[model samples]
Target: MTAAPHVPVNLADRLSRFSDLWSQKTVAGVNDYEVKIAKLKGEFVWHRHEDTDELFLVISGRLTIRLRDGDVVLEPGELFVVPRGAEHCPVADEETAILLLEPAGTLNTGDAGGPLTKAAEPLD
Candidate 1:
């Protein structure tokens, strides 16, 4: 089915539909990329997307993108882009909401597939 024309997707309402950490829900699409939202907590695996960069925008709480060189910390309303092929891990001390922009079907775990790897599901 197609979405209704001219009706904007509400991010907060979409986010409220789920509470599972580390699982991404597709909110919208931009060409070949998907705009996804996820609730994150604790530490994630070190992984790298060899072909596409990943953009992370924090909507609530704080997130730290840990890299080999250093860590990039982001607060609410902040964002960071992890360059392609760069090994990085995401860590959040508490529950954090984030929006991600990446190629459609990109695995959450990237090259380091594990139990945390989740396929993006469209928001209901």
Candidate 2:
């Protein structure tokens, strides 16, 4: 076995490689967590992670994390963590770029699996 190369990841460059909405692209990994990126627009399914928290960091545009209680709005360079088991729906009025930090293999659709579910593939 060999160690993976340590290198800097350019978020903008990685984001540019993909144009699909709601699809996650894995950019890097740390321990048991994966650093992923996605472009979001409109609304996403309401879902919850049963075992791990989900972190969403807005890279560009605006993101509204709709919770059962209310909504958490994030601007560029801002981030929010949705606690485990808490249901959330992410929405964006325009094309929004975001970075996600979660456990490896965590599903994008969480507890609500459907057509929008996407496995995070490595960026190319």
How do all models score by TM-score?
A: 0.96, 0.95
Residue 116 error for model 1, in Å? 0.9
lDDT of each: 0.93, 0.93
**Which candidate's TM-score is highest?**
1
What TM-score should be assigned to candidate 1? Answer: 0.96
- Weakest 10 consecutive residues of candidate 1 by summed lDDT: 1-10
* Candidate 2 to native Cα RMSD, angstroms: 2.1
Residue pairs in collision within model 1: none
lDDT of 1: 0.93
Question: RMSD to the native, candidate 1?
Answer: 1.0
| Number of backbone clashes in candidate 2 | 0
